[model samples]
Target: MENTEFRVELVRLVDESYPVVVGRDLEGSVAEFLADKHPDRRAAVITDSNVASLAAEGLLSSFGSRPADLVVFPAGEASKTREVKERVEDELIARGFGRDTVIVALGGGVVTDLAGFVAATFTRGVPYVSLTTTLLGAADAAIGGKTAVDTPAATNLIGAFHQPAAVFIDLDRWLTLSDRQIREGLGETVKHACIADAVFFEALEDAFVERGLSPAEFVRDDALAELTARRNCEIKRDFVTSDVHEGNRRMGLNLGHTIGRALETAAGYTLNHGECVAIGLALQSRLGERLGYCSPSDVARIEALLRAIGLPTKIPEEVPVDRIMEAMAHDKKGKAGAIRFVFQDGVGRLVVHDGGSYARPVAAEDVHAFLQSQV
Candidate 1:
């Protein structure tokens, strides 16, 4: 990819603020952003082994003359845990990092969440920037102030909302991803389109068919992919700006996350976050239609797009529905023993339903029935 530039606006969450800068070659720009925000002359970078080699090198090179440290974690969601957090914190302390130090997260959502949490809690919070390398991170996880580490019982159970100083998105990294990783990111992209922009969703569907593109090709076209990324980020920004703490409107972003999170835990963190989210989106759309929130045609469209993009539109055969529901009971969104779900009223609109009134929240019976319909 030649030199390319694109702009993504800043979203100021209540009591926090961060800029989401989307462009090519943003690895170098991260240093400039950090210098302006925290010129304290010391910083630490937390990244997974896989991404550290591919992406973190550019970021480290960018911080010329500044004192910086690198901390590596295992490369997967399983690393987002108490053990990893303790290790990262220990490294920071051993390095003699003070409150003046900044943390640069240089990987996917898991790295950003775990590292950002460390930055947020260490010495009552220090500055950090999000150098998102994955598409899912760039579109959703990286921009939102929400950071977390997972517990044995639930995913992202222990966490905080620590907004980053800035988010630098380098589209060039998309070219290096395997087809599977690219498909994983498309799941979230589809979610954004379903909940916020019908036009964007339709455009992607048309493009998928027209070019005979795989998920990898679809997301690597910098111009087209960046448009989708910006749209998803904007959807999240609008909600976060209105309900910064996720007290209300912002909860809509959890549309498929309720089931998605449950699926992750049920799979023992084996399923990719975006892949679980893809299945959750399909399930939720079916539920929406059953509840009169959407038309059958809309649900079909969603399923078709996900399938075309190489995402799983149904729950894995190995995981039973009962196990998934049991996991849902432990979701962070559940309250008073009832799981709360962000369902849709239609494309681009959402409704949050309390689970207490229904036996298997999200009307698991209804969801199961819908699944049968798909089969």
Candidate 2:
């Protein structure tokens, strides 16, 4: 037998980049940030009901003499839909805001995702900034420029790779978040540590054992939250800049997202994104151990850290494994019937498939078996 190999080159002319500003009292600085970033553009502020009251209104008022428009939607994963996207776009059109408009997303992950999606599509892509209020948005959703809206078929099914002009993480805003919301952000904060930095994982462990740090305490401690948020952003910046289109190392950022997203969709948006991600990390770590990519001790440590941070490490009895598997089939990482997954080689290292895919396709039966083990 003879061996044959072929190579293909795909070049993308992506020059998009943005600054992630993490600090306390950032709400008061939104106007300064926007004025310097998009000085001449009109502003279209997009936020949810909850955030509108807590941060959006304050942000708009901070704009001072700057002219701006405001649009508030009901808060939740449900609002990240095509219908909302259309309504938002129609409102912008009705107000006569053109491409010169700068969409300002002031809220949590949902607002950032939805507003970014709107910014990407409206008038063939306008500029946008992500002023995140929640920890989840600051740590994960607001940084990478992966804007999206959910669909009945799946979550984040319709979206675009539109980077923001800038991302602002207001540490003071954590004061307004419920404890549950802070915990949701920890789901991703722990995930970034598990997949990218072992020392970060250890620091998180120290925060728990020595400093008595927990998700509940995140709101009470701005210094700790700022450190965690900044590290997550640095890791994400490295990945997105290295592989903007998710062609290689960037996909590794989806460490637990394969199953995580499925859990979110299967739960019908009832489960918080980070809650589902915490469960997904638990299940995926076990799967990694089963396939010899990760050690059992490492899996145990991962679960323990997640638990210590006030995150759930097990699939809820309410969310059926079968339903989750069905949802995974429609995940964006799937090709034909093969679902691509990113597994950890160890803490801080990711498994790269023989074909150079950060995410490798696993058989459906294998996935089903993995799911079964969780139950």
User: What does candidate 1's lDDT look like per residue over 1-375, in tens digits?
Assistant: 799989899875455666788888886688887778788648899999999889777778888988789999999978999899999998889989888888888888999999999989988998788888888887788877889999977668899988898887788878788887888888888888877887888788887755668766776677787887788788888878887766767777777888788887777667888899998998888877777778998888888888888788787777776777777765666655456667776776665456522112445555445555654
lDDT assessment of candidate 2: 0.85
Whose lDDT is greatest here? 2
Worst 10 residues of 1 by lDDT: 355-364
How high is each candidate's TM-score?
A: 0.87, 0.88
Question: Model 1's lDDT to the true fold?
Answer: 0.80
Query: How displaced is residue 160 in candidate 2, in Å?
Result: 2.3
Model 2 agreement with the true structure over 1-375: per-residue lDDT tens digits: 898988788887766767788888776667887888789999999999998888766777788999999998999988999999999999999999997999999888899999999999998999998888888888888877899998877668899989998888888888878878888888888889888899888888888746767566756676677789899999888888888777788888888889988888889788888898998888888998988998988998888888887888887889888899888887767666567888988787788888777888888888887788777
For model 2, the superposed segments whose C-alpha errors exceed 4 Å read 1-14, 334-339
Q: Give the TM-score (vs. native) of candidate 2.
A: 0.88
List lDDT for all candidates, in order.
0.80, 0.85
Q: Model 1 Cα RMSD, Å?
A: 9.6
